[model samples]
Target: MGLSSRSVFGLVVSVGLAGAVGAQVTLPPPAPRPEMPEYVPPSQRVDEEEPAFDPSSVEFDPIWTLDEDGKVVGPDGLAEIAALRHNPLITEDLFPIIETILEDRAKEMDTKVFVYPRKAIDALTGAIDNFDVRKEDTRNVMGEIANSLNVSEGLVSWLRDQGLITEEMSMVSFNIMQDYTKRTMDQIAASMPDADQLDLISHQSRFLVRLGLQEPLSAFGRLSRKVLELHPDVVENAAELLELKGRDFLDEVAKALKPLDDDQLKALFKEAYESLHGPVVNSADTDEKIEGKPVGDR
Candidate 1:
């Protein structure tokens, strides 16, 4: 063993060559460490069998629903639909009231009753019955005004610009105005003698003509004119009274008329009627003129 130096040197060289060969061999990166799943408590774990999102499974609320018009299906919309469905203008039997009012008028007028065409009664009756419809329309308009940022906000802005209305009082005024209008409508509908009022309107030839011509809104406007002509003092102070105390104004108006007998009422109606239509032109007046003419002129 001591004499084998050449053999020992060859063995060392073989060991060095094996180490170099192992270093030269490239190994793939140790397979990336497998990631651990995040720990979840038993109570917090989502079940694997749970269903995915489904819209139908959710509860429906009409308030949140968008209608065909892109507006919310709110309580107001529902009420309007119901109101239109049950409106007396469309649904109620108005013919009975019309016949009754006509019969009463005929008894009073005798031969003169024939002068009023059936169309006049139809117009007046329709207007009276449609009062509820008009009220509903007014409520909708007011609701729209209140809901619209542009209109309501514009009112506030305009009031501020005027320097007459304080910001706090502007909204108060708006609310009060709405309340006054609603109360005024209620008083007029409840206290004004419906039958007598109908009769009063029946005598106004111009009012009937206007209503028959499909100018109901204009006919209503002229009603205010007639009221002014009849009671100028009452109307002059109406705005102030309405703002301060709206409920009693129309009641007082109704009470004032209670003292008049039939003859007195007819006289008032005649004045109003004549003022509205002028003197009734007739063939008799024309005949008088024609007969008075000179023969040669004729």
Candidate 2:
């Protein structure tokens, strides 16, 4: 079905600017990020041995099977459970990769960010149903920009009135800007903690935020979008995601992989204590195990 043409002209309010084009936006509650073991830094856990997603190897299940009673079992049931994981191919043990990405992003303290005002009327005409996202998202971004004093919706509307923005492009940009803002700004705030955490957040927070708190998450999101976009049949697009259902999907994948090559991966996970994070040569003799065999655990 096509998106409705009716929502293109909806207005957002700006800092007390009622029904104005751009406005200070309020974001919805963010889901809590699950805690992981603090003993090992995320980078050391996954290390470089972990493989990146192989686009060709991905296979998605089609048509969730159901019994006469509509209950699923066996492989079909397993798939129903697996499908709940965002990308079945990517496992939950891979959370470290995300943290690694966040850590890496911290090095980029000067990434350039642009704030666009709003798209003109002609552009906003047909963007209502593209992703089934809420209209208020745009309002929040508009509010963000307006609060930031970047631009206003009225000005953008005037430009559209002047034939600058095509109707189709307006709404798309309207939501796109909102999306960029919603996804990035707070992430930068959250992942990149202020001075408060430094005395406490371990050195990781400083490095990750400077590198780009949003990079790993962005990389994850990109990979997810790419997988679904490339294989629309095997995956759910943002529309079908419903809510933050992707987290559950990843958890199942983690369970599936928890046992595969366990001893080897566990060994590798622990190897960091020596090779990647060896603090002193003498300390190595203190006591440790490598590959289920004792390094010095005599």
Candidate 3:
């Protein structure tokens, strides 16, 4: 007697319901959590034994060997002998042994100055031997010269580009730039109200040198005269400005002149004059008033 399909299905559903009801039933409380172990910090731990400082010893070959004449013959020995002969401190041998030690000590302390290493000398000689007057090489030489003279390489390059200088004329270009800078500085010093103010003149010269101004100093001299004509008190004004602004005023002036074309530069000079003099009432106005008064009609 096999069970029917419907009876089997009913038996499975009843089993599933029993399992669900069992799962819904409340369980007893969980057991208390186990206690955690205390922490042991690394600093509190015991240290391991340290190893001893013994290093493997090595034997070196002797630098000098005795000759039949009982003379030290190696390179180092020969060098030491040469040093002994040259040393002025070993004048008269007081005690032979002490003199030897003193000579060795002096040789050890005698630092060689102004000496180029053999490899360095060789390299420099090689470079000189291989030197060529190519465009790039010429530019490099010009740049170095310009740097030494405290002028700008760009100025030199510009001069070359303008055909004022050629590759063969690099040194000539440098001399010209140097002369220009000196002449410009001298002109500026002369144009100053107090040419004897060396410190002030030096400051101005350094400023110009840093700017590497390409224009002739006569242009600047003319500009200075124009400034004075517009405002006779410009020197006093400059002193006040310097006191208030320190180097900033000079820096700003340099910046303004840096990119100016010739026309723009001339306009700038005129504008500076007009700006200073524009606000002042004419002396003719006061004169006119006095003249109209009819010589103090009493």
lDDT of 2: 0.32
lDDT of 3 by residue, 221-283 (tens): 224344344554534444333342323443333333344355544344544434533432342
Against the hidden true structure, what lDDT does model 1 obtain? 0.36
Query: What TM-score should be assigned to candidate 2?
Result: 0.16
- Candidate 1 deviation (Cα RMSD): 25.8
Q: How does model 1 score by TM-score?
A: 0.19
Estimate, for each residue in 233-256, the C-alpha lDDT of model 1 and write its tens digit.
643454443333222332333334
lDDT of 2 by residue, 166-267 (tens): 443334333433333343444445645653543323333322221221222222222333333433443323335323334343323223223335343223
CA-only RMSD, every prediction: 25.8, 34.6, 33.0
Score residue 252 of candidate 1 by CA lDDT: 38
Residue 269, model 3: Cα distance from true site in angstroms: 3.7
Off by over 4 Å in 2: 1-199, 203-213, 232-239, 242-298
Model 1 alpha-carbon miss at residue 142, Å: 32
Give the top-scoring candidate (lDDT): 3
User: Lowest summed lDDT over 10 consecutive residues: which window, candidate 3?
Assistant: 108-117
